[model samples]
Target chain A: MARVELNGVRKTYPNGFQAIHGIDVNIADGEFIVLVGPSGCGKSTLLRMVAGLETVTDGEISIGERVVNQLEPADRDIAMVFQNYALYPHMTVYNNMAYGLRNRGTPKDEIEKRVRKAADILELSEDQLARKPRQLSGGQRQRVAMGRAIVREPEVFLFDEPLSNLDAKLRVQMRLEIKRLQRSLGTTSIYVTHDQVEAMTMADRLVVMNGGRAEQIGTPMEVYERPATVFVAGFIGSPAMNFLEGRAEGGKVVVNGAAGLAAPADIPDGPVLVGLRPEHLAVVDGGAAMLELAAEAVEPLGADTLVHGRLGDGQLVTIRLSGTPTFGEGDRIALAAEAANLHFFDPETGRRI
Target chain B: MVENRPFATFVSHFVLILGVAIVAFPIWITFVAATHDGVRITQVPLPLLPGDQLFANLESAFFTGVGNAREQSVGMMLFNSLVMALMIAGGKIAISLLSAFAIVYFRFPFRMGFFWMIFITLMLPVEVRILPTFAVVANLGMLNSYWGLSIPLIASATATFMFRQVFLTVPDELLEAARIDGAGPLKFFRDILLPLSRTNIAALFVILFIYGWNQYLWPLLVTTDKSMYTVVMGIKQMLEAAEESPEWHLIMLTTLLAMLPPVLVVVVMQKMFVKGLTETEK
Candidate 1:
């Protein structure tokens, strides 16, 4: 219901460890912004700062029009779903969902109506509503957690890795459910997760973070198709983007002791790193092969076969091909990628060329 | 359980039985003496068997009290002991819970300093500071009152420390959830924390109740009025009276009554007590 904006938000712990450097992100109303990063990359810290759970060492956060840097979490009108689901272990599902409404002094009938509606939306039956959180299955507990947030009718929702505790299958189901729920509720939500897949699928506009800084923020397709930096290029894809160290010379990238590869025309003559996503690489016929790889291992995943190997210049590379591939270990395979699919970055600064 | 060795099992059972007998011997002797007449109780080695005076001795202890020391009924003393024990137990749990919640959740100046001051009281027990504590109670004009009997002993460090440890084990996420739920401090304490620590409170109540009921030296120093005498200290008065005129049956009868409440509490709530002692949460 409200747009959230963080202007130069930072978090510095009391021990003088700066977990989050200054980060500025403006999320439109009803947008799902997923902050994705590896461990200790300040994604959770940034989310907590927005939630008002952690103090902002520097900068301002605004939920709607009011700057909420000084407001308490309760006063900020936001509800957070924790990674552990954090349901009150002693309270039944009905009471847990009703807790916030009751605390806000909503009328009793209104509280019951909202709780029942949320439970219905979450598909928690009457019998399940009476049970404690410990008695519910892991997926059901996660639903109740979402139900708790849904009944709040708050301005924004904060999910702190809410689906990380579920099994693989359940995580996918809940991920879709959460996406549908957020769309239906039209609530601005900020989800934090270390899993890039969750970030890619759930985020309307994803924020890729690295070393306490926002590396890139854009739509999933945009960030995937055009990653801004080497970190984003390496992090966004499933098998990760393969990087080859080469020098740019006269509008071409030359790998030492290997054949020269095509580079984007705008890239200047200097040390550059070439990135090619695994899915973008194709196994080519003998005559048109652009790069030769010595296959070290092969993973046949039914839908896509992944070939992990070393390139001619001794760089580790992974190539993804559709359906089953007949490639075997130690097979010298020729692979080719279109010039438009290639990513170019500077070796010194790791910035995009 | 892993290996069924008959000889080892037999030795374990035999040792446990021996320990039980050693502990129960005094209670057996007290029971035997209470069942006998005054003259029979005063006889050598006491009566090993019941002597038909059990009901009579119980009635005398309940209605007319033991010997003739200050003429207050043992029933009245038992009532006083119950009041004092309940007050101490309830008061200690209430204060310790609040203090523990404050110390664990809030940030303020001198917080650790105040916690350490409360902790320091553990090193200075009532036995060590009896005179000054007695003076404070007497100056408040609370002598011979229930406040005099319980309040001075209610500020417990052990219960506070136990509750603090319990609160620390609670995940920080629960607090964040509560805060987002719009629950202020008091509501969170009532609806969440108090319920979670229910078993611990019951267990601590058992311990603190027994401690309060068994008080001898402090109650002996404070309550000069016979009506205010608790049953445990009242037993000492009965024993002193028995020195002049042997009323061993009546004295033993009062001693039995004094020990019954705490024993029954432990026996009845044994499950919760064990759960509280061993496990913090499900």
Candidate 2:
């Protein structure tokens, strides 16, 4: 219903400690933007600022072309599903779903109708709807929390780590469920999460943040394939993008005691680093200018394996390989980085070269 | 397990029975004292059974002493006590709830200092402030009236403190949800905060009810008229009315009747009170 734009928004606590350092984000109408970051990275704080839960310390926030820096959270036309669910323990699921509508002065019959409709969409049984949140399972409670938001039919749906409390399997299931729900509803949603996988899988556009600044904003694939900065490359992927410390000279990047690979670009004068994705490193027979590893350990999964090793200058690197590696701990192996997949960064500033 | 532990179970039952007896004895004493006649009550060994003197003692207790003001009857005194308790309880709860909501939900200048000041009132007993409170109420022209008797005794520091404690435990998320739901402070308190505080409300009701029902000194000082005498004061008046000999049996019986309402409320709701107290408010 609305495209929310945080134009130079900032938040500072009363004691004058700044939490958000003037963030500017423009989310299109009906866009699903995921704010992803490590803990204390100000992602949730930024989302809350958009939702108007937090007071805007400095700049303007506009939703649907109307400035709402001074608007109340409810008046902002955004419904947020909190991390703890925050279900009214005394109220039944039905009432919980109807709470927003009732507060908005919706008709008694309409509240009931909308509540029943939401309950059906959430797959809540009549019995579950009548039961208190305390009696419901965690996933069920989460659904009721979702129902509480959906019944409002707000301009934006803000989710604050909503699935963090669920079990691993439930988190995955709920993650897909939420993605499908957002797709069908097409509400402008801003979901905050620390889980990279959640951000990678669910976001239409991922806004990766660090230290109160937006690290990168793009499609998940774009962030993965072409990270603009070193932090974005490392934070977006699990086990992280491998960084090999070396110097760029004579059209080649060299790591001590390892074979040097030809640099893609004109020789960056001196200090440089090579970044490679784990999955892109194909295990080839030892030869040529490809990086050779003295494997430190091998972690095998039923589906795939991860090879952990130390680069010559001792940066920890992990490689994703298919099937259990026949190679054991401390085996000598050769890894070839797909030329297109290799990323070059300036060693001092960490900006991609 | 039952088959394996018969003797241990029997001992447990025996201990339970003793505990029950210990709890039941005070009530039992009141009942027996109510039934005994004058001479038997004053005798070395008190009457342990209901006696024929019950009706006569009741009749005198109801109809004696200082005129229609009912200084004569413990029955009139019981009515006064009930009226006073209900008023005080209702008034105390109403004031405390508002103050609690203000302090708990809203941020104001000097909010912490205000909270500390209110909490300090609890540390200072009503007994200590009775003279000053009475003076203030008297000066306000509320003496000898129901309003006078009720208002001063019913403003509770403890109720507000307890309610704030409960509000503190309520997840910040719930309040945030209500705000996002478009509720202002008034609507938020009415729809969410008040309802969620059912346990604390019950606990405060219990405390306020007992405080009002059992108050002796404040009402005694405020209501100089005999007709307005509370049940606590009524019992003291019983001795004065006894021209020849005091009817200790009648006095005890009337006291038991006066104590019933609050006693029953506590009996039924004591568990809720404890449950309310134990909450983490996290």
Candidate 3:
């Protein structure tokens, strides 16, 4: 319903500790944007600032063309679902969902109608609506929290790790439900999570943050295929991308303890960092192998086997192979990567080339 | 208790029964004395068994009145005590609830200073500062009135501190959520905090009611009119009649009447009292 924009926003505490250092993101109307990072990386802080829960120390946040830095959270027309499902424990599920509407002085029949509709959409039973929050299971409490937000029909919905409290199976189920709900409602939403998988699956575009700065903001596939920095390449992937210290000289790359590897012509002759995705590496014939790995350990997942080993230069690498692998511990495996799959970064700055 | 160890259970039950007997002996004696006529109650070694004169003695104590305090009946004294206790309990809970809410939630200047100031009053109870308190009440022309008896003992530091602890345990996100729901401070207090602390309030009311009921010295000093006399003070007046023998049966009956309301309060709110003292549910 509204496009939310953050223009060089920063949050500085009174004691001189800075939490968020200048983040800017222009979220389009009805687009779901996710802010994902490790804990203490200021992703939550950024979301809180936009929600008007925290004061913006610098820059402007405008939602629907109005600067909202001075507005209260309620005045900004945003509803947030907390990580712990911050439902009113003493009130029944119906009152918990209708509290905001009642506070806004909505008519009794209208409030009841909206509440019933939200509960129905959330799949909460009629009997469950009359029960208090403590009586509901964890997932049902989460639905009540979602119902509370949806009943308001606010312009923007903010979710702060709402699925993190549920069990694993419920988390997955609720994740799909949330995505489906957002698609049907077409409300502009900003979700914050420390889990990269949640961010990748839920966001129209993901803002991968580190140390209070947006390291990369792109669609999941775009960020995965073309990481802007070594940190992004490492943080966004499961099993993580492996890095090796190497040098590019005279149109060839010489990695430590390996035969000469192919390099793009544009790469300058200097010390560089090489990145290779685990799944991108394939088992090749011995003569065509780009690097020989001294196998150290093996983890056989049902669909794919993970081979963790050390390259000859003593750099550890993990290789994801389809199906069961014939090689076990202490067996050398010949692995090779296509020229396009190798990602190069500068050794000094860790920026991708 | 259900461990299937018969000897251990027997020992524990024996100790509990012994404790109950020790505590209940005086109350049992009071009941027995109330059952006899005045002359029989004053006889040697006192009566250990009930007599048929219990109704006669209760009627005399409830309607006709006791010696030396004959101008006002025992029923009137009980009414006075009831009013004072209810006022004190309700007033203390209200004032302490507001003060505690202010101290915990607001960030005014010198907030902790104000809290410690209230905490310091715990040392200066009515006995310690009775003269100044009585002087102030007398100057305000509240002597021989209900306000003089209840108001002097209403501001409770213990109740304030207890409420502060209860408020502190409430999660911060609840406040944040309520704020986003557009509730102002007073609305939040009435709708959220009061309901959340319901058990604690009930528990504090029970204790404060007893405290107000048992007040003797302050009520004795303030009320000169016979109609203003509290039940506890009336019992002492009954025992101190100089010219004639005390009405032992009537005094015992009045004492039994004085104990009823507080006992009723404790019994009625027993579950909430235990829960309030033990657990803080979210």
In candidate 1, stretches whose alpha carbon ends up further than 4 angstroms from where it belongs are A257-259, B1-15, B242-244, B273-282
Candidate 2 vs candidate 3, DockQ winner = 3
lDDT of model 3, residue A127 = 99
Candidate 3 lDDT over residue span B105-224, tens digit each: 998999999999999999999999999999999999999999999998999999999999999988877887887888878988898899889888998988999999999999999999
Judged by DockQ, which candidate is best?
1
lDDT of 2 by residue, A28-76 (tens): 9989999998999899999888888888889899999999988889888
- Candidate with the greatest lDDT versus the true structure: 3
Output the worst ten-in-a-row residue range by lDDT, candidate 3 chain B. Answer: B272-281
Model 2 TM-score on a 0 to 1 scale: 0.93
Clashing pairs in 2: B64-B72, B169-B281
lDDT of 1 by residue, B193-217 (tens): 9988888899898899999889899
Candidate 1 structure quality by residue, lDDT tens digits, A266-297: 87998889999999999989778778899999
Worst 10 residues of 3 chain A by lDDT: A251-260
* Per-model DockQ against the true two-chain complex: 0.73, 0.63, 0.68
